[model samples]
Target: MSNSALIERIAARGDGVTGDGRHVAGAVPGDRVRDDGIIIPGPNRAEPPCRHFGKCGGCELQHVAESALADFVHDRVVGALAGQDVPVGEVLPAQLSAPQSRRRAALTALRTGKQVAIGFNAAQSNQIVDMRECPLLLPELFALIAPLRDLLADIAPPRRPVKVKLQMLDQGVELVLEGVKAEGLDAAMALQDFAGAHALARLAVDQGYGLETLWQPEPPTVVFGDVTVEVPPFAFLQATTAGQAALVDAVTRAIGDAGAVADLFAGVGTFALSIQQGRKVYAAEGARDAIAALMGAANRARALVATEHRDLFRRPLIPAELNRFGAVILDPPRAGAEEQVVQLAAADTPVIAYVSCNPASFARDAKLLVADGYTLDWVQPVGQFRWSTHVELAARFSK
Candidate 1:
């Protein structure tokens, strides 16, 4: 057997060394393996706030200390760029919202013949982990968890997976369900019972037992800087509060002396309105609802802003369009803006700040910008989603 292939198969468990030297265990829980075949501790190992620590796949760093996680992420970003002439900045500590602060969405499975919910995906698999509560989700969300489990258990399709999506708006909580199936009129009775008992604001079903609805008496809203952003039940926004804040800070700092800014892939104007205090901002996003809501919010705040609906993936900035903005802020999806980066590099824009959830794509695009004479000023890491290997970063490129 080849030595490299042999080392690949070793799976070390429980912070200790197996008799074989192939893998060394580290104190951390989620991510331990380094390039040198050494295991390292996870970020939340020292103090995991949630009772579901180590077991819940949602938070990989539950077993490692928060401070350590910051260092670990910073190192990971630095290591990711290795020989690049990029300067590393503070790996900012995320401002953690109270447990159950997630106003976003997800679904879980139902235990067969049991009145329990199999919540969240298992580590590295689609299998759901049966859970009573998720600390990371908003506290209001927890109230629905147990009752929903009971409702599913009593339903005919007891073994089906159910989705629980909650959006907290300015008025109240909005709840929706998906992937449920029902056999008869009894399902309607069940829905009514669940809604009444839960005091839901809306109770709408999708097709069968696969869909249900529950919500608070009003809409769900969030506060960003001085603005309160209202969220619809089925809209897209950042899942973590701290992560969103950190990203906004990074983008604002990158704008520096620029008087006019163009924000691409702007969702709900999280960055546009917040950073437009002293500048004219143009936000372009493909999501109709998000753009419309953002435009309304901007007008209410009396901020100078305009919204455009465009799929940035298919069509980014043109050369002529680039010279119009003093600076640009991009918060593209995981696929990072490759074509946009090229156009910006060729344009006359003086500065650009990019927020990316995926590091590999960011590095690839950064390399392109660097090739075009843009110098990377800061590579800051934000540990927004506390667990798993996913990392969010903000970078500044100056012409």
Candidate 2:
């Protein structure tokens, strides 16, 4: 065992890193790499469940055991913060979403002659995997794959790629097909019958122009807490319900007892709406459609949520404005909130709950906040994108 090269951890791109700095593909932590490049199976390695394990771009860490998988997620955050020289605080146990829990997915489909191939693209390539079985997506969403193949054969142009987006709304599955044309009365009838037979929540298509709804029984809505908001086409959503719960719970704990909160980069009120009870929340977002949806839901629920469609990057809240709120919830995109964090650093905001998808970017921003006297209290890691290298987390920063 001492002679063997020991795999210590998983790298950012899903490769296993040995203690001596060798990167081994398809290797998991605790696995041993022999001198001749043979990999000895480790206790932390599990047999990949899907047939397309190595090829499909949907999942990268399916071969990792549950315990090791959690470690990979937890280490991603700690390592990132360590890279930025930010002090690591209490790291709560990692929360992993169950398989088949993914509620939203965007897939690529191609039609060649009489056959249509559809699934996620092959890892790092444009080739579609032609999905036979998926253990990642919700069963209801995966059920549409076979039917979609047949449907796309009729509408999707030959030999061209079409984008298929599926989301599980409260009503049912919302389906959106882009790069597809359904012309003529026969094509229209086929789409109508398909939507009716499948009981689709909403079905829309994009030919060459923008998305046009072909069949919508009702406005597709998703519930945040108790309030329901009709989401726009392909609206951003937390990958899984369990994952969303983990983040929301972390956020609630992070901003404990703060009666006034500001939710920056609020996407359709994921954090704002969930944490609005007994508190006044000023929700600000850049996307017009998302803000409009949040405002409508908050108005209808009579919640103390004030919505504004302002891009935090271009017009960040100044220290004077930021000091008005007792606490701030910053959930920025993958590129982190640089401008807003700069302003937040100068403000007297007592508490900050920062939710982020990219550990590296979050660590970069956390460095800024810490330099301004805010303490990095704790971070709760979430494996929302199960079996993937992607990581998300919620953290607390106190002044």
Candidate 3:
């Protein structure tokens, strides 16, 4: 080991890399690695706030500096495109969701010997880390950990696993407990009291029979733009509000002033509701409950959003139907809407806004679109689940 090496960038798995391509875990860019194998600290490193930083699977890059984290997010999108040999016109700075702003999360709770351990599972393991303090979750969501532990201790069988779902609705917190039952009279009363005391918007439980509403003063709804859509159990919403905003803004800019747009894989009209002003949007979703909710909200608001219940994977919108729109919007699942993208590739829609959580899948689909004469104009990377490898982006493609 003759020459000292300098770390050039962070890798996909949160590891730092030198110019010669040596991987160093917990090392940041501009850091130096001496011949003696000592890592000199660099500017792109941050002290992890949580005590369970190393053990908790909730976060991986907390030790990396903010700039490095943002770089990692931005690089992920670029790297994915490079892998597929897709050319991009521009790549914007990464938009990161702030700490303590996660509006929804799924947690696991296990009760054992008069104690309840409630938190996320360890990295790549089933073991749960009892969260003391989380910098990622909304303050409101974290506040329920203690009370939820107490509630689970009463109803959950000893040494049994309980799945806890928490969401921040416009009205208040909504709690859904699965793998636990409240059949006994005392347990039922306890659940009702817990919901009331916490001012929960709704409380439901599933004891293998499926979720049944235990307490609900009113239906649970989430506001998307000006319309209030009745949310079904565990429906898909962006993990963070800021992340959602960034994605919506990019999509809106991509299809600026387009007369008619088609929102494929529209989950409860998250984009349709926001970007549909003065424009008629044909929103299609596979989920029955989600489409119903979107239709109800659009009808109530007179939003000019036409809702349809169709599985894009099974019966994608053909080019003939897709060509009628001035622009097309796609927010597909992780697998990346191959069947639909094939149709979109040859469509004469002129503009396309593709929102994706998986960069690799997006790249694969982008190649198909590019082959059919669509130009990859620009991309906006968004880091919603911060400190993790999960990356999302919105890209505009034109024919």
Best prediction by lDDT: 2
Local distance difference test, each candidate: 0.67, 0.95, 0.92
TM-score of each: 0.80, 0.98, 0.97
Model 1 lDDT per residue over 24-102, tens place? 4334424445555655444335656766665666766555565555655665566556545444443444343334566
* Cα lDDT, model 3, residue 120: 94
Give per-residue lDDT, candidate 1, residue 57.
Answer: 66
What tens-digit string does per-residue lDDT give for candidate 2 at 1-399? 336798999999999999889999989998998878889998998989999999999999999999999999999999999999998668888999999999999999999997999999999999999999999999999999999999998999998999999999998999999998899998999999999999999998999899999888988899998999999987899999999999999999999999899999999999999999999999999999999999999999999999999989999999999999999999999999999999999999999999999999999999999999999999999999999999999999999
lDDT of 1 at 267: 85
Tens-digit lDDT track of model 3 for 155-253: 997887899999999878999999996888999999999999999999999999988998889888988888889888778899999999999999999
Kindly provide the TM-score of model 1 when superposed on the true structure, using C-alpha atoms: 0.80
Candidate 3 overall lDDT versus native: 0.92
RMSD of each: 5.5, 1.2, 1.4
Off by over 4 Å in 1: 1-55, 83-101, 154-156, 182-205, 208-220, 300-302
**Model 3 TM-score (2 dp):** 0.97
